[model samples]
Target chain A: MLISSAQGAVRAADTLITANWLDYLLIAIYFAFVLGIGFMARRQVSDSIDFFLSGRSLPAWVTGLAFISANLGAVEIMGMSATGAQMGLPTVHYFWVGAIPAMLFLGVVMMPFYYGSKVRSVPEFMLRRFGPGAHLVNSLSFALAQLLIAGVNLYLLASIVHALLGWPMWTALIVAAVIVLSYITLGGLSAAIYNEVLQFFVIVASLLPLTLIGLHRVGGYGGLKDKITAAAANNDKITPAKDQLESWPGLPLSGFDSPLLSVIGIVFGLGFVLSFGYWTTNFVEVQRAMASNSISAARKTPIIGAFPKMFVPFIVILPGMVAAVLVNEIVQLKASGGEAAIPGGASGDVKYNDALLLLMRDVLPNGLLGLAIAGLLAAFMAGMAANISAFNTVFSYDLWQTYVQKDKPDHYYLGIGRLATFAATVVAIFTATIAGKFGNIMDYLQTLFGFFNAPLFATFILGMFWKRMTATAGWMGLVAGTLSAIAVWSAGEFGKAFELSGQGLAFVAASTAFVVDIVVSVVVSLMTAPKPEGSLKGLVYSETPKEDLIDPHEASLPFFQRTVPLALIALAMVLVLNVIF
Target chain B: MSHTPERYDAEDARDDVREDVADAGTDTGSGRHTAGAFDIRNIIGALLSIYGLILTLASFVGDQSLDKTGGVRANLWTGLALLAAGLAFMAWAKAKPIVVPDHIPHDDDRPAGH
Candidate 1:
């Protein structure tokens, strides 16, 4: 075998992740401690509120960390690493442009309605503002979406744990589900939040070492970029021109090797529409903000989250960049030996999804390796817990309680909430089983995210700010918006089924839905009778007074005490990274 | 729209425990802050302590490896680190006990059980 002159040669046999007693001890301790937390949290389950919102007593810091950690799923760790390796610095767009601005908007603009309006779920806001029809549509879709997400998390966890533990895939999944569900059922949202905080810390601890070690081995950040450029030059297939490697965030929609979606897609679709829709309206993120006890705490949740979020591309995407370079070096070494000068040359095929796994096997030692693997395992569980916890609440409150039974005792709902956790877990297990049949699970999940969140932001914006918007108009716009997204996504799936180079026009459809929802909402609103501002207190901009929305505590503190300063800092960091890279 | 306390959960307030923390900010810490709200720090410490003790003990008995683990007994190191964290959490919780004001005002109409 040709030894490539990069950092060091990685033999095939060395990739095996063998766990000694120390490693097993760490893993065992992790599981036991997790189960213990579940048991401990059990006593605190006083009512349905405690079961769902952790009694809404979490301070800003807890909710804030949980908010982002809830999202740092298997997808973000694995898929985003693949993105970083494939796209280079531009994948940072996902954190910077796609998430941060929208997160800020959610904190500053939407918290009044979400937190102050006394809504239990996102759909509750729909019910209060737009009435039953819209509530039914939003809540049902959200519930289903969450279940599918839980399954995706399950599949990712099972697959990775299967690799690390060398256990049957089913065994790993069942153990994870049992562990996560136990705590969730016992402690409820509080359990999920508490665990999410743990997962957040663990993920950071696990990934930080990998980045530092990899950077040290490959030389520092300066050398890292230079190595990538040199590799790109040698492997001409990465891009047509060396100019592509000149700066960070190369050409948009340049495809494969190029980082970033097209400028139009990033600005119009992601930055303007999709980001706003998902961050502002998605119940998953909004739930964390809503759980804070005080108004200021709730509003500050996402803002605090945004700070850590800015650094995530470094944690997630940088490793991918390193992996991509390593893959190229291996491929280049093989090609020099007169093999097929083709796409699948030298190393057969390097699975980008396995980039972090490769990095782990290459760099991390067995004990820390096991801990790192555990951290990864925790990430998936945190994601799974977030989904199942959210799903159970929405399912119980929105569907089961609303449509099936009504006005039972508080204890009755609390029991149902616990029961709902099991139900959600079962559905997720089944969903993960089915998801195994899919060709690419990531694409399937992305389609679901885009299908729901893309158009919903328009309805949310109008509903929150526009008093003249009728309840009928709100529901109608939402329905029309949802249908348009579906139509586009379905068409793409249809095209792909026939082997036509036509997989869904994600950005095109999302951007179009943003416009379509706005037009449909305005036209429908004018046609229907307007709801008066007086009847919309706490739910609409005009009636939800600015004073009620303002953080009373913020005034007593300095400007830096507020979230805006942190948001500004986050933005400044993004700008600096963009320039340097 | 006539207000009957908004019936917070339309399904059956009995099953009303879903969604993110947003519309669910009913915990003003007004109602009984005690029944096991050990600042969440307590649990973190407990967890760290449990893991630390187990791993620390295993470090002596477990198969030693320099080739596999970059010459570091990571379990032993990480375990000790976690132990300290757990103990610190216990100390912090003991040092300061927080009490919620009796009348925490908010516009969130507290549903039954909230």
Candidate 2:
């Protein structure tokens, strides 16, 4: 195939890969490894909590690894890379400012209530306090969120395979989905958690080496710095610049005035909304927290989870920036009538995905490439496994028995959970196949997931704070929030009534739903005969503690004393970096 | 009136049973309290339920530019207060000291036998 005309930057990558066998071997090996792990863990899978929630036996560290691993899907690696390719360093704020704080708060604050309440799923908690309606809304919202999220994860996995091995996108997606589903189906959450831990390590090993080498290849660290500095020197960098510039400090467009309100809106809306939503509502990761053996263990899990998240940006994002500098230079070379070889269209979505591929093919040499490929594969497996396991668990517990066979046997329910896992995987495969056709599938999937997330998280949070939030009001608020998000998206996509904003819209919709739900639920709860706060003990843990509950400071006193100071120290480091850089 | 040794032994047995059930690997006894000791799903869920609580407060604070604008000290303080409260709720799952319900219907009473 003829290289694209504007193939200035990818010329180096274009010439290097004459050997197809190596790519196939790499992918096959990657597949075998992940499936093998799943098979091995399958033995440990029990029918009840062990299979569903890892027997709640995982200590802090393993739980921590599984937690981080589960979060590491193709969405983050590719999405953040695309962001980094455009945005630069300020995007790191997504972790330091947004995720870390949330995780820390979740660890120190949220763990006790959940641990004490002894609920299985977050929605199950809602049902005990509110009613069946609350549980239904929560479970449905979660299922929807996981549904789209699974497709997106598969799509990213497929893109990498397609780019590396020249497999058809759909072919790659099917293969990826089947491999992931086979093991995930076999092992359930136990295998998923165990495999996730392994995948986390593999991804780190794969990316870190490539990142270091890539930096070195681009004229060492010093040379690399000069290249990006030159790129930034171009004032025209604004339009085609990476997606994250709005958050970069001292970058001409940091917040509100940036070309799009997306960044500012995310900062204002999503920083809080998504953090709380994912932390509280998303059961996939929180299930790991729930599976912790002790209250103290659960409390420490989020904190431990936060530390890796702090570093992940550097591992994934920095290399993309390096690749951007390299790719842009190639474009400049081609502009001069040089035989510049680019693999795909430069500056488009395809090239954005290909940029990382190009970097890997070009920079990673022998055994190292195998390792790096393994990392990508690890990311692929871990991400997919997390989604599949969570979906299966929710489907089995929340949907299958709850709706289909309310009085099924334990063995029967376990069988159903396994069946649900298979069904969920099938749905994902079909969805990813359809989603694959869309060029900017990653971006679209995230926004759509955000739409589903905005309302449910908002209602659940409000129900806790406001005593008056009745079940009827929660249902109303959930409907309102989801509809509000849909209305925003619909107006932007279908009606063209208003310009479609990005992350900001999700935030606004989520916020509006939360506010409205509280208002309506409170009014209705109070106006209609109020239910006496009966059996609301373990259900709602507002500001006051039950008598036996130890003060958190006293309960995990030793850990808290050290962690608080340590967190402050890290905060200081970030502040210092801001000042210096 | 309730000082029987058998009663104390029975209470101990029940505690052991509860702990055993908590770790009941796949044993979903009819009355099994899946809600474990460290279950923060609700608290986290609740805080998360109120989406953007902190962000909303942060916006108002930033809008007033209280640090920069010199708004009424109370507005500044209130913003600070809301921020702290929001952070506290989001951070400490046990921030809301939930009193374990006084009346947990016995699993024996429930139709499902644990």
Candidate 3:
């Protein structure tokens, strides 16, 4: 699968976009700044804390942008645009319904416990609240997950390099891996965070122009809508034009025959369980919030990110929708049931993944094309760096320091972290090959989230709220929850029992994992002996004082600067968007 | 607070005072040398400005390719916008620089328990 895809990518490379010296210059300049920032950040890393968590000294704005940009990987950008092309406006749910509320919850409710306790990583928090059993389970699983997901990002990154410069697959993989490895090992989390902020702007600068030009080509919003309606009339496989244009009760995107079941699945499975599981508990994003300077800044990081996140669909999804109408290849693919042979390329079929590339080739001129390519590079690096940094922190602080060398000096652990970063990047190159076997990367990603994050969120939320939850229950619930999600996924994949596939099956699996984990936790808690109340201070919600969870200084600040007000405003704005679309 | 003994260190108390002073300095619109050598805003501004400058130059000298984008000079417009954004970031950084205390407190001083 990997070899075939590489061959196909090589064949499609020349036809995608031809670049000149100017494009190469822009890319080279971007690389120079990326490395320069890494070198500058290295000077600040004096201790383990600085290497792992930026010393918890960064202001909220920097962490906030990093929080979002770390997530805007090449897979996310391309996958989302592909989703937009296939599902139309309904893709907005992944942002508004699935992401925003969870991010707000993380900011308003969860960050206090995380930041106030001063845990370097999420699994460390698990150790404090639960015990060694759950902490070990969480850390090992988290380390493995980050490596695999890092491979996904690395694979896509290498593919983009190959597509741009026509480099051999192995050569592209090694170069991309080395560049990310250099920055992360040099400056640690600070380097990753700073570059993520820069990448956020570059991503916006590149995608915004593509979106505007694509919209203009389709004759504005009305023209796009008319074209979509006409196309829907001809294509029987697609959802109706009305359903395609609207965001609510999305039947096609959810893969449910009944409207009621579709809405329920979206609301409970995706909106509540999967979204919260990924956003609130996933260490990649929580690591960003945990790096904020103060309690208030920590709480406001995700809220600040929410403001930009809600509007991202306008740039990302709108371009895909415009491409569906404007690009002939995409239209033909959609008409022929999503797989049609390309005219001259060795790639047999033009998938929805080609929508953004096709639109860029069709619309963007030379210089702007270079910027877009740079944006992609920035995104992929940001993603892989987030994974590697998070992995190193867990490996050094949570796993190594906790288990292997308990009394090692701080600098020893820091050295271990740097080594871990280098090792993880090399491992990701091998794992990237594993990622290439899958036809649709999104399904693979969602299933992995089901296995890792969903169960972990259940354990965290239950243990944090209910002090009676025991250490045995903590690990037990995680193990059982993860096993159940896997069982359900296997049944769906092999037995075809769920009558669902793609994201819907992943959703159902996650929801089952969450519910089963919660139930098992509650049952196990009643049977097992709990930790003493005195040890639970600052770990459990009921035992901790209110002051520890809130910044006292925030009382004097204006309403706009406060966490709750900003979160509420963001919530209201997203709701308005849902209604508008 | 048996759970966290490190929160009561004298170093933390001193750093708290420094943080307050630094926060006040930024609030009152006074420039302070906080992470001055490695301010992220400066780096971001510099990169954006260079990209913006190159794109702006390329718009005039490089291929216009009017036929591709339906007769729009995308490079020119995007270049100007990026240049403006880059300048704004630099100005914002100059006006309100982030204040980093010398010793930022790390509250996780408890021993790792197995």
Candidate 4:
């Protein structure tokens, strides 16, 4: 009997996810709602603006949920949980220390410039501040980045479907792509945003139960802590229990031995450069804010998102921690230094990425298991749709409309946007194959962000505030910054120049890019002539009047509704959370 | 600023057409107060309600799997919570419907001059 029970454990790994009919029904219902929202939203798209920006008419709550949901893609869910399983408590820094402050800064300081200027996309904002050179560079790079990232999301989504239903990989990929493509093509940004809002709730619903059930199984947080401590003592390969339990310094997460250097890397590199660069400027996130009905709503969007954003670690990261302690497969894989096969994992290898799936298989029953599967689908689709929608907008407005075909009618551009969406979806299917080639897609994703966003953020912060920054400086700064980042990344990737590896390398690369861009912009501005003060009126912060930057009506609202007060409250809450954890 | 009046007149015309459609009963007017023709809340509420119903029914009829979750009836509880949340969203939508204005001007409708 004992021998047979042991043999059963070995067999259980091969068939990890076994969903009954009830689970499939839940997933079918979810897909129906997703596609239905798309068809409904299609009716509202009368022009390019509606197709691209939802006609800037959505309220704060909808756009706010969409803002965070667009970001809560497959990477955010699976990747963060994987990180939680690997690095433990230090992963919380990605949210509290890294995201919240920058998000608040975007709301209080940056949203006024972005929304007040009324740019269709982030690249368009670059065009207004810089010129054709910078705009072209920004547009092409952004479009390429979206396609690559969309591929990553698409690949993960298809892999989940393949794992869940035992479908062939090719069939899974095509079926997943068509679902997202159909909705995005039908509804445009409105469809994407509505689905995103729905996705957010679905994600929370699915993960929250997993976390609770896992915690309950492990004898709560206290029991998990004891198990982690015991595991750390037994396994010398993993991070120390103390480092795993605490959020400070994050030595293991940073890949640095020295505590001081690790803190600086976490605070400046990840928190300031990468975090601010991403939350403030990424068009995928910024487009949600731009779809708001009013300037005040736009400003409140990110700030509202920040509220839910801070607490997400509980559902996402906690489950990972629980899995690390509770799941026999993960424990064995971790001890084996991830050399073992993860049984039913899509990758065929025991990777940290399989932590969430393993945990769900161990804990959830059939009915709830189906809900969790649907949640993951919603996350990946929301992520891919965001990339595709943002890609189509930038392609139509920033690239094709601006350069390829000028002076087009509104409906003509709208048609181009839909075509671009189709082209991007098809391109993304191919890109997903490219993404599959990489061993760790997260490292690749971080490297891509470092290449595109870091330098762009540097140029934006400089040009927005410094009235004397020239158009020549704008493009030059971006080029030099990107090259410097690439150089730093390659040095770390291939050579032994930097002591860092993994995410630490990406952070260093981003910081180098930011500093290089600033230096280049300053030097170029000093040499070349600046744009005239008249042309810089609304683009430059100093030249734009205070009233024009904000909604005067927002002052009459209650403190909770006001942007500044709400941001401050959020800021205070995050700081308290930092102290407690 | 220059395109403000023209944009408003265009929106007013669209509003008139929408009102006529609403009177004809072809349009359900789910978003009569909202910007679009459909309320996102209703979609969310409807989806959650369906999922909640399935889970709730399954909790009674399907395998309990109480041993897997350490003796907890997770489906029953989570289904009830979802049902409550779904009903709350529906109620909130009914209580405070968003008012869509006739026109909301764009920041700049024209192409950026090179």
In the order shown, the chain A TM-scores of the predictions are 0.89, 0.86, 0.97, 0.97
lDDT of 1 at A255: 28
TM-score of each model, in listed order: 0.83, 0.74, 0.93, 0.92
**Tens-digit lDDT track for model 2 on A89-130?**
665655665566667766665666666676767767777667
TM-score comparison, 1 vs 4, better candidate: 4
What is model 4's native contact fraction? 0.47
User: How does model 4 fare in lDDT?
Assistant: 0.85
Off by over 4 Å in 3: A1-15, A343-348, B1-34, B99-114
Q: Over 4 Å off in model 4, which ranges? A: A1-15, B1-37, B99-114
Count clashing residue pairs per candidate.
17, 36, 0, 0
Each candidate: RMSD to true structure?
A: 8.4, 15.2, 4.8, 5.9
Question: Each candidate's iRMS in angstroms?
Answer: 8.0, 20.3, 6.3, 5.5
lDDT of model 3 at position A156: 83
Question: Which pairs of residues collide in model 4?
Answer: none
Q: Residues A1-581, candidate 4: write the lDDT tens digits.
A: 88966754554444558988999999999998899888877777777877898877677888999999998997778888888988799999989977899889988999999888878899999998998999999999999999999999998888787667666567778988999989988989989999999999999999999999999999999999999899888677878899999999798778888899899999998899988888888999999999887788899999999999999999999998998888888887777655666665666666777788889889999999999999999999999999999999999989998899988778888899888988998999999999877766667888899899999999999988999999999999999999999999999888878777447898899999999999999999999998986898778888999898899878887899999999999999998988887
What's the residue-level lDDT of A26 in candidate 1?
67
Could you tell me the lDDT of residue A325 within candidate 1?
59
As for candidate 3, its clashing pairs are none
TM-score for chain B considered on its own, for each of the candidates: 0.54, 0.27, 0.62, 0.58
lDDT of 3 by residue, A340-431 (tens): 67662112357777688778888999999999999988999999999999999999989999999888778898899989999999999999
Off by over 4 Å in 2: A1-33, A220-222, A232-264, A328-349, A494-504, A543-557, A560-581, B1-114
